[model samples]
Target: MKIGLYFGTFNPVHVGHVILANHMLHHTALDEIWMVVTPHNPHKKKHTLLDNHHRLEMVYKATEEYDHIHPSDIEFKLTQPNYTINTLVHLSEKFPQHEFAIMMGEDNLRSFHKWKNYEMILQDYDVFVYPRIAENQEEVILKSHPKVHLIQAPIVDISSTLIRKSIQDKKSVQHLLAPKVWSYIDLMNFYQ
Candidate 1:
């Protein structure tokens, strides 16, 4: 099976994520998209993130009804400071029968060169990049790389930060999250 690895902290899975994944699935040859919930993203502050299980549960609730969308916790067991190259290598070895592609936003592509062993990753795997609303445009060199595919997906402006802030402010986030996801957050009093 061909899988698109959509990795994120997913501190809380939101509708924009599911919609973007679904868009990628329809426009690409991918069979399924696994929303890999990262336990610790090197670029993000660990203190700001929720417990791993809580985040993972949100992903589960958000994607339960979609057959093509799945939640993954593959990074939780890995060593701290999870790197994309390492995760790619591990997934390749464990799922030898399947093919994997890195799914990311154009904003991330701008800094793709700075990632550890990024050159090696490009040489071995394909990268599916979607557009992002960034003040600075994505670097032309990386965007035009043979291994990097630019997908014309919907530009979703919704962000986890926005949702988190709203929740902390005790504002309604019903429109931003899936029903089950919102319910889960509400029941647990998360982000408040």
Candidate 2:
């Protein structure tokens, strides 16, 4: 089976995330979309993120109804300062029957070269890249690599940051988040 690993912190799982994920899963040859809940992304500040369990639960609520989309806490068990290469190798070893491909945004692809053992990652697995409305992006060689697939999934402008801020500011987020997720956040008073 071919799996597309969609990694994110998911501070609060929003509609844009589900839309893009569903589109990718259905449109591509992938058998499943695993929404990997990143414990602590090296690129992001640790303090700004919600508790790992909270983030994971939100992901569960966001993806519970979908048959193909799954919430993964694989990264939470791995060693800290985890790199993508390490997780890839671990997943391959743990689930030898399945093949894993990275599902990332174009924004991350721009800095793929700077990741730990990026050359090896490119050599080993396919990368499914989605569109993101980003600014000041510079051209990079990896963007044109044969292993990299530029999927035309809908461009998602919504972000976890935007949801967090909106909630903190007492703004309505009825449509931004799944109803269950919003209820969880509201009941817990997260990000406010």
Candidate 3:
């Protein structure tokens, strides 16, 4: 089976995420796309992130009805300051039956060279890159790589940061999230 691994904090799973995952599943040869919920991103500030469990639950609520998309907490058991290379290596060893491909935005691909053992990652795994509004040099790099493929997924400008700020400001987010997730966030008073 070929699986696309879409890694993110999922601070609170939003509609844009769901759309992107669905797009990957429908457009690519991938069997499924896992929304790998990272507990903490080494590159990001820890204080700005919500609790891992909360983020995971939101992902669950958002993905419950989907058969192709799954919420993964695989990173929770891994060591802190988790690097993508290490995670990919561990996943490859543990799930040898499935071929894993890295799913990422063009923006991240722009800085991919800075990642730990990025060269090895590019050589070993296929990368499914989605377009971002921002112009980046990574597009040129990815275009030249045999293992990288650009996917035409609908780009939504909505972001987790914007959703969180809207909630903090007591604004409506009905359009930004699934009803189940939005209700859960309202009940828990998250992001306030």
**Model 1 ranges off by over 4 Å:** none
Residue 144 miss distance in model 3 (angstroms):
1.8
* lDDT by residue (tens digit), candidate 2, 1-192: 999999999998899889988988988889999999999999899999999999999999999999999999999999987999999999999999999999999999988899999999999999999988778567856988988999998887898898899998999987899999999999999999
Model 3 CA deviation exceeding 4 Å by range: 135-139
Q: Which stretches of candidate 2 lie over 4 Å from their true place?
A: none
Weakest 10 consecutive residues of candidate 2 by summed lDDT: 132-141
Q: Rate the local accuracy (lDDT) of all candidates.
A: 0.92, 0.92, 0.90
Q: Candidate 3 at 88: error in angstroms?
A: 0.7
Query: Model 1 clash pairs?
Result: none
- Model 3, 1-192: lDDT tens digits are 999999999988899999999999999999999899998888889998889888989999999999988999999999999999988999999999999998998888888878899889989999999988885443455556888898998987888999999988989997899999999998998999
lDDT of 1 by residue, 1-192 (tens): 889999999878888999999999999988999999999988889999999999999999999999999999999889989899999999999999999999999999989999999999999899999999999863556887898999999999999999999988988889999999999999998989
TM-score of every model versus the real structure: 0.98, 0.98, 0.96
Ranking by lDDT: 1, 2, 3
